[model samples]
Structures are given as C-alpha cells and as structure tokens.
Target: MPSADLLLTDTHIRTLDPAQPEVTALAVAGGRIVAVGDTDDLVRDWQGPGTERIDLAGAHVLPGLVDSHSHPVWGLEMATGVDLSGVVDLDGLRGALRTADRLGGWVVGWGLDHNAFEGRPIHRELIEDVLGGAPAFLRLYDGHSALVSGAALDAARITGPRSFDQRAEVVCDGEGRPTGYLVEHAAMDLVYEVAPRASDQDRRAGLVELLSTMAATGLTGAHVMDGSGLDLLAAVEEGADLPLRLTVSPWCMPGVDRAGLDELVALQKLGGRRWRVGGVKFFMDGTVEGGTAWLEHADCHGQGTDAFWPDPAAYSEAVRHLHAAGVRTATHAIGDAAVRHALDTIEALGESGRGAHRIEHIESVPDDTIPRFAALGVAASMQPPHTAYTKGDHSDEWSKRLGDARAARAWRTRDLRDAGAVLALGSDWPIAHYDARKVLAMARVPEGAAGPAQGLTGLEALEGVTSHAAIAAGQAAEGGRIAVGLRADLTVLGLDPVTAPADEVAEAPVVLTVTDGRITHRGA
Candidate 1:
C-alpha cells in the first residue's frame, strides 16, 4: 500500500486524457496527483523514503465515477420511502399498504407504477378508502405524476374533482368524479405539496443516507437535481460525512422569475466553495409516461400528449438570465417539443456567449434538432440507462405511443456524440436507480440489451460518465480525470475499468475513494 504520498504500481490505468490515455502508475501526494507513469521506472528512479509503494498486479484503475446528474440526497428519501415499484392493481396495493403508516398529515409513498393499473391510472377512491382521515400522496417512479386520496384534494382546497383544470388531469370517472390519479406538472406539484415536505433535519438525514448508499454503489460524486441546492450545501457544510462529492443542480420552476434568478445568482456565487451548483435547472415540459411531455407529433396511441410550455418566451430570457448572471443552465425537457423549445431558447443567444445550455432527458430529440444542438453549442444531458429503459415489457404500450423509430432513440449517446454534441450522463435518479455502471453498460449495450446496432464501446461509454461530463460542467480544469495538480479526488475500484465486464460493473466494489487525500470510503 502507498502512503498518503504513495506510488501505486503494476496498474493499467485509463488516465481518460486525450493527450495520454493510458498510464501504469498513478502517484498521489497531498491528495492531488503528483505524478503518473511506469511504476517500475518511477520506483527505480523517483521513489522516495516517504513515498509508499503499492502493487496493483496490472489491474485497470480509472478516475472515480463522477455521476454527471442525479439527486443523491433526494434519492435517499425516496429509497427510505415505500417500495411501490411493482404494485399494479388495488389487490397488490392493499397487500403493500398493510405496512403503510398513518403519518397524521399526508401519508405519502412513492415509486408506484401506473402500467399495473387499468387505463394506467390509480383510482382516487381506492386511495381515500385506505387513507381515511388524512390526505395521501403516492408518486410514480418517474416523478411526473401522483395518485392522491380525495382527502388530498380537500387539503389542497379543491372543491370538487371537476374544479381542477385540464392540465392537472385529476382523472375524473365516467360520472365526472375524482379518480384519485393526477398527471403532468399540475399533478406532480399539487400532489407533491400534499406529501410531507422534508424538514431541515429530514434533509440532513437524507444526505447521510444518500452518501452512504452512493458510496456503496461505486459512485464518488453526483449532481443533485430538484431538491433545494442551498439546503444541500448547508448540509454538506454542517459536517455531513458524505464520501460522494456533491454538485447541486436544484430546480428553478417557472413561477420563479427575474427576482428569483437574482437570488439564484447570489447562491451560485456562494456555491462551488465546497460542493458546487453545477447549473440552473428548470422544467420546460412534463414526463412522457404521464402524458405531460410536449409533442410535435401526436401520440401514436391516439390520446394526445401534453405539450404545455410554461411561459416559453421567458425561457430565452431565463437562459440569458442564468448565463448573463454567470450560472450555467440545465433544463428538464422530457418531450421533443420541450427539447426543441429549450434549444431554440439557446439559439436565441445569437452571438451572445451563454455557455453550454443543457437539454435534460432528450428522450425524443428530433433528427433536425439533433445536429443543431452541437451547432447551437448545447450539451445533451441525457440518461444512458434508458437505452435499456424501453426494453421493459411494461413499456410496450408506451412504445406504441412513441411509434417505433423515435422510441428507439431513447438514449442516443452515440448519435449525440457523432452530432458533435457533448454527452453528459445521469441516472435521472429515482426515475431509474442511480447506478453509474448501469449508465455505462446501457451506453455500450446499444440496444441497451435490445438493439445490437446501438451498443457503444466501453471507452466511449465510460467517457460519458467522466471527462466528457466534466467538460459539460465547464470544469475542465477541476474534474473528470486523474492528473497532476488537479484536486486529489479519485475512486479505487477493485477491478480495472479497461477490462471489467458489464456483468461485473454494477457489483464491482470500490476499494477506496480518495478525496483530497482522505479516504472517505473503503471496502475490501
């Protein structure tokens, strides 16, 4: 084993730098890499009395996984929440609800799948029966919609199920009664508010849970979305012993205007001290499964998809606002329309350097819009796992809505890369489990376990999770690779990434994670 300033040898390491892609030895001193080269040669020549020497026996070591996007802290809460991923019908729901707690306020549970229900919607009456006194809110795995008890509507002050507008999609029955289902942004927000909000303590504890689970999954860094960015920073500073480095990319909903942008700017200025505020996050459209995702083409299922834009014109201004104020922008655009709208917002920059505007999800980026992204200098912040996402049997009906060709482009890492778009990978945590290797495997698996033509090489996929992700964040100097003078943040995997098989990636243990020379996590 090498000392704090040790020389680890006999290692096939992917430096992940274009100039020099491979190195046998990686030298760490004072946390930042001091040197990297032939272990035998360096040892024979530069080895010092204090330099600890360790043997790798030719294992493949690469830079630690820098999860480009995820809400690690937020994921912790969801993980602790009820596991409703497989409940399809009321029979399954009741069986699981035997343990459902009567939390006094809103008895909230998440990760329910509508694919299991008839018409793909959970009836509101069923929820009300189980949730007698208080309101109850349950979220779908994608976080796009919620199933609420009738009590939830009263808590929110909705007089009748009919009172709610079309956007909310309260799911009225044939008799115009509340059906217990909510869809799109309206349902997402309305039902979310009904759920118990995480208090400061709850948030802090979530971080603790988040960091532990993240480290266990071979992740060393993450970009947290949706949750309060400022609160995360405060929690990080409050002595939260999270091994994972944090990048807070909090949500900036439309209700937030110029005044709010100013506050965000102030927060951004203060960010990057310890943990960083990676970019400005905003919702441009809704989720597809929830029927909120904007559509240029009609739903193939004959049912219309939601293309509701929240103040479209203001988006360009908002893009410029974040850029002019000097905060990077990452917008959540699940639909093709949202993706196009966001790109158009960036294109409006028109000779103004707004930095890299990120287009989240890109589930259905049209071919024309694909090439324009690079020309427009926008990074496609996409989910690589969705490469395998559509393969699930439950997605067949949703696939019917997407048609065929467009649906196949779910995780277009290679296309985005070939189009000259910078590709940054994320799990869209909670939407899909936040597993870095799964992202890598999906990127290479092409068909993501479905289409052989779409699979990428391991290296191409690894880059999406590493250096490329670093470049997207405009932190080329501080991140994505193991190099001299760069901050000493590295992950020591038990196996070498260069040769580690896909089956082994997800389970590959991280032996040690060194952040600034301190071993934050160690697993044998």
Candidate 2:
C-alpha cells in the first residue's frame, strides 16, 4: 500500500524486529523503511515508479552494526606514529623503533599493551636508549598509559611527573624521581599536552580517512568514547559526506574549574543532528592491564590499591548534577572497585536518573555487583578482546593479581546478561582491532583462549554488539533493526552471520552500508 522509493530483496533478513521476526525482503521509501516481507509483497505493495531495487542474492542483511566505544583518532594516528602492537619482544620493539622516523619531529609510538611486554619493567633509561633525545612518546595498549623521555617531557613543559598528568597519575619512584610510565588518563593527556596538536586540516583529513576505514570494516555507527574537537572530526566528515552517525561522549577535565563541566557540556551540544551527546565520560578507575585500573588488591609496586571509588561523595554529587541537567554519565570502571564505585555513584543520583549511565569495561567486577548493574538498569558496556588477549600467556599476572575467584568474574558478559544487565559490546578500537564482526566474535569465540566452552553464540554476541549497543547509545528506536518505518541504516554482508563460521563471520566482507536511504559505502 505504501509507495516505496526502493526495494531491497532476496536476502535472509534478521530484522532484529521481534514483531515480524524474519523477512525475506526489505522495502525503502524516501530513505526510510516502507515494508519488509516476501519479495512479492515488498515489490507489489511498496515498490514505486523509478524505485531502485537491490537484489541481495540470498546474502545476509541487517541493521548496520553500531560500535559502542572507540578512540577513532588514536587508532589511525598510530598508522602515522610508531606502531608497536605487532612487536614480539624487546628486539622486535627495538627493530620497529629503529625504523620509525619522525619526518623531522619527535617520534611517537602507540599500541603497546603492558601485558605484551616481557620480564623487564618499562624504564626511562630504556626509552632513552631507544629514542635518546629525539623527544619520543609511547602510548600503552589501552591508550590509557604511556612512556616518555625527559626530552619529550621537557618539550611538553612537564617539569615534573605532575605536569604531564591530568586525571591519571604519572609514575614516580623513590627519591621523587619520575618514571617513563604514565598511567590511564595520565597517558592520554601527555600526548595532547606536549605532542603537537593536529591542524584543522590535518584533523579533517584524519577523520575522513578514519571514517572510510570504519566503513570498510562495516561500522555504520560509532561512539567517540574520547573527548571532542570539531577540528578533529572534520576529516571524518569529509570522508563520510553522507553525515556519519556518531555520538560524542566528552571527558571530564579539571582545568575548567567550577563551570568547566557546564561549559564543556554546552560545547559538546554542538555535535549537530548527525552526532548526539551520548553521555559525559568520567574515569572511576583506570585500565585493567595498566595497573592504574583500581583493583581490590595492591599493584606490583604496592602503590596502595590501583582502584578506588575516588571521593564517593564528590563522584555521587557530580552524577546528581549531570542527571539533574539531563546529561547521561558514562564512567570508565575496569576493576571491581571502580565498577562498584560507579554503581554506587549512579545509585546515589536517585530516581532523577534521566540517562542510561554506563560503566565502560566492567572487566574485573565483583560477583555480587552483577545483579546491582541490572537492578539499577546500568549497562555494562564491554570489549571482548580483553578475554581473548588474556587467554594467552599475558594472563598470568592478571590471574595472580585477581586470583581464580575474581579472575573468573573477568568480562562475564553472559553473566551480566543473565543477571538482567544490558550488555553492549565493542572493540574499544586502538586497544583491540577486531572489527564490528570481531567484537561479535568475542561473544561467540572461546573464552580465555581455552576453547569453545567459554565462547558465546553468534546471535548472543551479535545482539550485544548490535541491538544492545544501540540501546546503550539511546538510538535503539532506529539504529539496531531492519524493518518498515525504521531508518535505512543497514549493512549488507557477503555471508549470513546467523550461520556463518565464527572466523568467517568476522572476516565477512560488507557488500554495502546504507545510511539515510543513500548508499554511503559499497564494495567494489
């Protein structure tokens, strides 16, 4: 009955729309879904004159995957910086650093997981040996930590460890000497404080290139988990001219003083229609591997507990302020203490909770808190690679630090789901490279690298990465499903995800990604 602008048919459609369940065809009109049914019904009732129809040829079709969290610039910049993610050992690292050139500037390298390092601690002298006075900076794998030289520190005007540090701490040793390692939020700011800020043109270019990169990987929508900079996103917009669907979650920085949060919230409001203000990001703890991630137990050097609630009253009061003002709160809480702290703060905000405050990571949460997340309706926004990455030899320390009981609680998505918590999965890119499909692989692949027994199923994982992720982003109404009346944001895959091999599911090529009724990306 509805005249449609286009008809997409002959695909096994997992509508993710429970009402009609599965459909063999999809109909679109004016860039909005018109109907979905058998090919005959879609063509007969919805297809209009001059309708552009696509024959999917029995491939898989669904709403485009929405990546819940990632630092887009950080990952791509690594392409231009030192990429040590692939290094196997000290020798390999030395070899990579030796080959990395600064094009007449300081050499900055990203993508090293502390777990990826061998026996030796990351030392200042060691960095000096490799980089000498070249003014170099190396970011930890989580993008939450870094190791920099005195030259680089001086260039940034960091007279002491405190200068390079912000919300995160800079590591120092006995006698008040600085160490090369800066943890969590500390590491991220070090680059921004000292490293050259990208020009508007450079940022624009980076965004364009990065958006194109995400499209190739089949991500139709993504959340900018880091802070905001219009200049930086220009590059993404240039590449994705169709208006990429992005949500910007700004970080809470201290320098702003009393009105800082308020002013920044207003600034973030300029994301326009295409980008929504998802939430405000506050770090409750730190990244798990970095040892800054607040844990119940002591860290390696006994810097007290790595994780703490961070002035619970203040944290609670802040949430109340945000909740009262209509901005959602999304905090970084990797270890149990952090998660517990985040939950407590959210709980303190009372029923005025207008937004879906989420706990990013929730990696090493306590068993009892599982129900708390669901009870409070807080989403457990998670990344899968933590499980996969830890399954190998890198897991030993985490196992020892967490012990068996706690470690078993590591990244319990299934438990979270069963306990009634919303589970939203993402790659946490730059930290992990598994694509839209790869994040799903975490749900279906074996856990802790032991085998299939630990893995989740394709549907379970896909829901977390897709529907649930969209829900967490507050775009659940239109972003996660394929159906009539829904926005025409979909990803056409070469293989059917429901029945495809786990490996192939992740590797499956995206035939096309449609946004707003126009084909933004199509495979050659």
Candidate 3:
C-alpha cells in the first residue's frame, strides 16, 4: 500500500457520515482521504518516514464547509469601493463619500440603506454636494437600487425617464427629469457602463485575498452564483491558485435565446480541479426592499412588478429549455409570488435528471409553497446573516413592506427542512458577511431576527453549511463527507460545534483548513 502524503491525528472529527460519525484520525494522499480510524492505529499503519503528520491536539474537525450561494467576485469588487454599511444618516453618508473622494478616482460606494436615513429623500443634489462635483455612485444594501451624483448621471447620459423589461425605473422628478436614484439592474447598469471598472490585476489580487479569507473562515468550496465565471477562469489561468473549490454559475438573464443558451452550455466545457461552470443563474424577481419582487399583491398600495422575463410563460419555457439541455438552474426568487413561479416552473419540467434545481433567497414563501420545494426536489439556498440587516420589529423596510404576517414567514429554513427540502446555506457575500461560522450561528438562532420559529438546531444548521450545501452544489458524491476516497477537504475548529454552547459554536475559531489534501490555512 502507498504511504499517505499527510496524516492528521489527535483530533475530534465529525465525519457527518452515518456509518462512522466520529473519528480521531485521518490520512490523506493524492488529494483524497485514504483512511480514517483511531489516532494510534492509523498513525502506526499509515504514517511513513516521509509523511507529514500534524497533531491537532484535540481540535474538532468536520467536512470543509460549502457556501451554496455566494458572489465572490462581486464581494471583491465591493471591497474596492467605499463600504457604506456602517453609515447611519445623511451626515454619515456624506462623510463616507468624502472619505471615498479622498481615495481619488471615481467615487463608488455600496451598502447604503435608505431605511437608515430616517425617511430623508435621496436626491442628486445631495450626493453632488457631498462629493463637490465629483462623479459618484452609491448602491443600496439590497444591490437593487443606487444613487448617482449629477456628474455620474451626465456620464451615463441619463437625462430623462427610461423603461426596462425588468421593472427598473430611473426615478424621475415631477418634471420628468431623472432623479439620482436608480432601481434594479437595468437602471443601475447605465451608471456601471460608464463607471471605472476594476482592472484585471485588481480583480486577480482581490480574488486571491477573498479566497484566502474564505479558507480562514472554514470554507473549502463555494457555489459562485453570478456572471464572473470567466474572470475566475482567467485568474486561475494567470497562476492564482485558489484555496477553495468553486462551482461557477454564469448568469442567464431573461430574454436569452437558443444561441445564448448554447453559449452558456459551452461554459460547462471549462472545468478543472478548482473550478467548474456547474449551472446557470436567473433572477426571477428583484428584491423586496426595492419594491420589485413579485409579491402576491401590491405592498401597501405599491404594485410590485411581474417576473424579470416579462412573460411568465417565457420564463417557464426558458427553464424547460435549460432543463432539457441538462443544465442546472438556480433562480433568485425573493417574494412569495416569484418563489411560487420558480417552483412551479421546476415542477413542470418534471425532473431534469441532471441535478437538483435550486431556489436562491426564498425570503418570503407562503406556508403552502414550502412543501413544493421538497416535492419538486429543489434545493433551498438561503442566507441567514442577511437577517442581521433587519430590526425584526417591523420597523425595517423589508418588514414594513412585507407587513406583519408575511414578514413573519421570512426565510423559513426550519419549515423547509420540516417539509423535507434540502437546505443549503450561505452568506451571499458582499450582501452579507461570508464567514461560515457566522452563518451557522445565525441559522441556529434566527428567531426574531429572520423570523419567529425559523431557527434550526445546531446540528441541522451545521449540516446546512456542510452536507446539504454540497448536495445543493451537486458535489455530494465526491465531497461533503469524510469517507475514504472523498476529497480531503476538512475544517478543523477549536471545539465540537454540536455539543458546544451556542456562543462557543459561534465564536469557535477555525484552527486549520485542508482542501485536496493540502493545508490551505493553519493557525495556532
């Protein structure tokens, strides 16, 4: 028998395997687990003169975590921009812009929440004054709306009202003049087209930094749900050795034709050990806070729009086409109506036979709609940390728009689990913090924050980020477990999360992270 390349011993390992749930030691070779057994026994039999044996000193180990839905590229780009998540009022907003202006170049900021402004109307004049005539664009926390300075508006050549297929509106003053606020991607893209883009080098550096951070936070894999697959591929080709495995999902926007579908299908040909274009992403509706999600009815007399595809039948047909082509689909569906539409489309497809389809951000679902997820074998990709942005007292914009009853049903993770749905949790990074520990912590105590009675048990929450997450990404066969022959991706924590107190679980440090038999992160 070949000697193992590395041996990890003297640890408490939770394999998440029913047959052998716990083990003290494991051996890795050629990027895969070769054996797992008693520490002394494995060391005696598998350890070699050349083997690298690391004593874990009783640290707890589990399968390396998988974030079922995230936007790593977007997160990195946001990092380069001014972070307005901490700004509270108009003064704070102005201060943030001023600081960003000092950084030089075009001023761009994200994570501005209008709810924090105490109902102060955002206008072009206000932003123009802050930057002193500099070109600036500030995106709301939801990523569904943005405010631009007058210079930015001019740069984009937006002087009048514009229409979009996706219900986006360039807010207009009574005189039909464009306000600074832009809603949804269609409107936001106008400014982005003129905004200075991060250079390839900048993106490469940012991605490397982001991956290292993810490894430290206990993530060995992520399902990247955005249009940056090509960028990731380029980064890898440029000799950036990413620490985590990535399954990229290229964005498949509404109105895509057969040729577009074929283009997306071709992306599947690009696959390597570290990355693969595993699926296509679609936005069924916009965010609730943006007043664009396809709610059951108008929220407080605000008529939410139709699906992004404009024609519901066309959206369903697109899903059918993709499903027929053996491509997995993950639709961003926040409102109950949007979630139902996605679920209905998947159900109508009647089993793609390739992999499980997914619904991203089922933020609001009717009770009856919960069971359909399991019934249709759709994975529920959710982010518990997103609830942190809300007050839970019905004062936040989302809750106020959703009203008391619907708000109570936000992110029904437990209910979905109860209905036998596969729960795959993530941070949706750039929207929320990407730490797996924080996600686990939030899932375990989501009551009041996300919604009453929405919390999961500690074990269940852990599974959401591990086994279930892997299942969602279609990697359960080769990863997500500590069985022999599975990829040697593991996260060593300071304590056993299952048996530890909630605080301990939340605060437990990642002592080490191993992916493909290689130690990606190690801490004393």
Q: Report the lDDT of model 1 for residue 346.
A: 82
Off by over 4 Å in 3: 102-104, 352-355, 447-449
How accurate locally is residue 461 in candidate 3, as Cα lDDT from 0 to 100? 86
Instruction: Candidate 2: list runs displaced more than 4 Å.
Output: 1-3, 74-79, 163-167, 187-191, 234-243, 254-258, 264-268, 304-310, 352-355, 392-397, 446-454
User: If scored against the real structure, what TM-score would every candidate get?
Assistant: 0.88, 0.91, 0.96
Q: lDDT tens string, model 1, 31-101? A: 67777777776677657788766676635567767777786665655544567877766778766765676
Q: For each candidate, what is the lDDT?
A: 0.68, 0.71, 0.83
Question: What is the TM-score (0 to 1) of candidate 1?
Answer: 0.88
Please provide, for model 2 over 147-263, each residue's C-alpha lDDT reduced to its tens digit, 9 standing for 90 to 100. 877777677666555743234666677755667677666554655576755666776776766776777667777877766565456434445562357787877643334487676
lDDT of 3 by residue, 182-253 (tens): 988889899888888777777777688788888998899899998674656565656756788888998887
**Candidate 2 vs candidate 3, TM-score winner:** 3
Candidate order, TM-score descending: 3, 2, 1
* TM-score: model 2 vs. ground truth: 0.91
Clashes of each: 8, 9, 0
